[model samples]
Target: MASFSGFIRKSPDARLAVFLNAKGVHAPDDFNWQSEGRGTKLVNDINGLIAELPEGTQDRVKAELDHLASLATPQTMTAAEQVCTAQRIDLEGLQGIQDVLLMLAIDHPKTLERVAAQASLMQRTGGKNWSAFQFEDDGEPWALGDDIARAGFVTDAIALLNLPEHRKREADWYTSIRVHPITGEETEVLQATIYVEARAESELTFGPSEGLERQVFQRVLEVGIACNAKERIVEICANGGKKIRDQYASSFAKHFAPQSAPPVEAPRRDVLLNALLSNPSFPTEPADGIAKVQVSSLEFYSVGGGFARFEHLGDDETIYQFLERQFGAQSPIHSTGWTITGATLRIMQTPEDGTGLSVSDDNQCRFLTISGDRFNAAQHGRCC
Candidate 1:
């Protein structure tokens, strides 16, 4: 047997031939390392040799194999193709050398000399069935591909790799609520949730018409599953998936129909208050005497001013009466002349609590001193 040190000193090709011959596989007279099936055969022979070696000698053998696998040459594309072939054949069985080869193909400056070869290798190796890869962290294999894609690599390969598996899988359907931004009203949304076998589920909502909705959901689901783009999937669902629907318009054209316009948002406090006022049970008349009143909306400005719009009150109601009814009878607004235009009602003022309230010229908006427990309490009360 050739000494292991002599084996380490041999050129990569010579070492590969020797390794193969030791496993009863013959190297032809003009053995080509780049020949089809040669790289996988070489890798398998090397793995067998490592298994037969003593535990202490295994690491050195692996290191030498790593060097051989990642050896850079003017024929970078040929080398990359061989590595990809070997990895595709024995990714999990190769004792981390396969990952080393992949990283070298992707990250090494010398191997990146051929951009076309790099891209080709990425597509070939990355496009292998995604389920066959094992992620080290949480076992979500697609996440590994996503990390590669996020590093500015092509995602089409990842998409291609995951497509077949997704096609054969069944999706779970569930109802999700989408809340109106202005009204806080919730609408039930239907979502199709699909996942890689034994992995996390990704959910995407359906679109407008039944037929088109199916197409949109399927397209988004496929892409989302391919890329593991959970956040993007959620955004598309929220926005009605219009961009995606437009993408496959040819397929969806027959299913097209007019979608109902989204609810027009009430942009102003008065408009929202008017809608509340339309309710018969809502108070339209001012309280005959001091009584609790519900505040409809409050907006604060950074320029030391803001406004609170109530649902409705009798036209004859005075600012003092409104303040008393809204804040409570014992509130500081009850101080004499406090209701006067331009009057400032100071309350809870201290080194810590600097809260104060002042009437604006119109008495509709109030300038507020922003800090302190009182303001927070008032804001919290309205929110709750």
Candidate 2:
């Protein structure tokens, strides 16, 4: 039986300990082969195991044990640097081989050494490119000799690709930047592609032409930013050039067409007049920043909707126009055809738009309301 304490300084020694442990040695702590008289037993055990193995396996195990003994020298702590002295291995490459060596120390020392040598070679030569590998004209992809050879090639290629310089070369050209207006957050967009296709036969005049035609189209993506208010998309580019258009019978037939419908227009005043006379209430104050006039009954309607707010300017003019000019004729303060009955007040054509006024019983003209087909008195209140 043997014990390992200081003797188990590195992976090779650890591998030896595992081997010894599996053999029912009962290896104890503070194990020193020479001082504790266990050295003879250990040697005898190793010899017995080797004698049982095949000749080739015996030789390999013996050689590896010898190598491990040599590696136990004091300076072996830095043995990796000594072994890879002139070889150029990137940190990643060095770490990869080191991991393999540690993992296989017990049974595959020779393989570990071979892999390390190959890794160093790749580090020096910057790895072999797959495209540069020669292939047989018989249609085979590549001739990498055997599975082990292919693995080595792939390992080297991975090391090279992990380098920052290699990655930059493979990165796409255009970088997209997107920012959220509300949060002021930015995001990077790696790639965006727009595919365009056309038909070959569509361009032919007489008989059946060729098959389908596809073309590569490239264009710039423009982004704009504005402040103080929200931004809106004004337009999008659709043309993929003339050759593409001709092949697709004057347009890209595969692309979806955007459908746009016209805005719904407000109902005409004449139609709304009857509804107003019956209900006699405004739906809502005109959209904020605009004023509207409404007449509940025929008497108010006869006065032409209580004279639109900015009437002195023209029949077609509105308060918005008056404010823009900043020099318009004063608006007349004539009766807005409003009449109060109990708590409810009725007025001519409801102002379709305005910074709505609040109404209460105590406030003068505060109970003001409007009646018109367009206005629903029940729905309208102080602007939300």
Candidate 3:
């Protein structure tokens, strides 16, 4: 083990890392694959690098390196522990499973240590919100707490996960490293989170199996001058720099130097409108075989916009026939009128004819009412 130094800086666009050490090596592609034996190798490699450092500095990093290696085993609370934690009775009075889980998770010794490490780094680097590169656990953002604390929000999230209909929920741990590209100096922090249904009860039956996601950040000293045109914001860098070396380079500079306003232009309303309407790409159409089918259910992964849109068909009719009738054989499906309000979808068959289906949304469509002669193929159904 060796002493690691410097502020951690993440690349704006890549998960790949570049160390500023003697070898300047990049971590193995599988550096984060904890269970697949890849993470073990990565840990070994780091240990080897640490060993090469002078004896005096080794004492500084041995423990931390060992801890990183320990994470090769995915972190999660056992069912008994989770249940117990959720049902715990404390000074707050009777707590719901969600309340217990949230408090326990936030106060998790490992999680608290990680959060503290991040806060220390932010303070050391003079990094502030939006200015510092954020580390994401999987796709979820992780951040330090504020003066009022982040407990309320974390509780709300756990409550959502513990909804009556949910079968299981899990929390997994990950880590991110920030290093000085020129010095191999570094700071690493653990980040833990659970993706929607990531470790459901069914998933845990097979033992620890969630995947680990990781990233390392390294800072490079580069200066950038920005020039903005109507369509492009070009960056000219020092030492003949032609492009932006890193997205956060400007922020890094602002931290150490007086900030200057770079040239900026607001687009005109006409330009903005044109950009929105021109060459718009509509969402992909449902698969050809997706029609006249009953929907069993929908699973939402995130609260924003919620559930992913997927249409599944029951075994009633061949998808071809449904599509052929819905869209005229010789022409594309042209919507004469469509209105989506609340949970109902009202669509007109054609401008000249009142023929279409009125679909209601639920866990599944409760009813799909057909109108006019458009879908007259089936006696009870309406199709042409």
Candidate 1 residue pairs that clash:
none
Model 3 lDDT on a 0 to 1 scale: 0.29
For residue 56, what is the lDDT in candidate 3?
49
Off by over 4 Å in 2: 1-14, 17-37, 81-104, 107-384
Q: 145, model 3: CA deviation in Å?
A: 3.8
Task: Quantify all predictions' global Cα lDDT against the true fold.
Answer: 0.32, 0.30, 0.29
Best-fitting candidate, scored by TM-score: 2
Q: Write the per-residue lDDT of candidate 3 for residues 295-375, one digit (tens) a residue.
A: 221211222323222122434543334444555543112222221111111121222232333343222222332221111
Q: Candidates' TM-scores? A: 0.18, 0.19, 0.16
Task: Order candidates by TM-score, high to low.
Answer: 2, 1, 3
**Alpha carbon deviation, residue 340, candidate 2 (Å):** 99
List, residue by residue over 142-176, the lDDT tens digit for candidate 1. 22223332322122222323445444443333233
Per candidate, the number of residue pairs that clash is: 0, 22, 13
lDDT of 2 by residue, 52-154 (tens): 7666666665565454444433233232332333222222432232232444463445433533333332222211210011111332222222344334433
Worst 10 residues of 2 by lDDT: 225-234
Off by over 4 Å in 3: 1-143, 146-148, 159-162, 165-177, 187-190, 194-384
- Candidate 3 positional error at 193, Å: 3.3
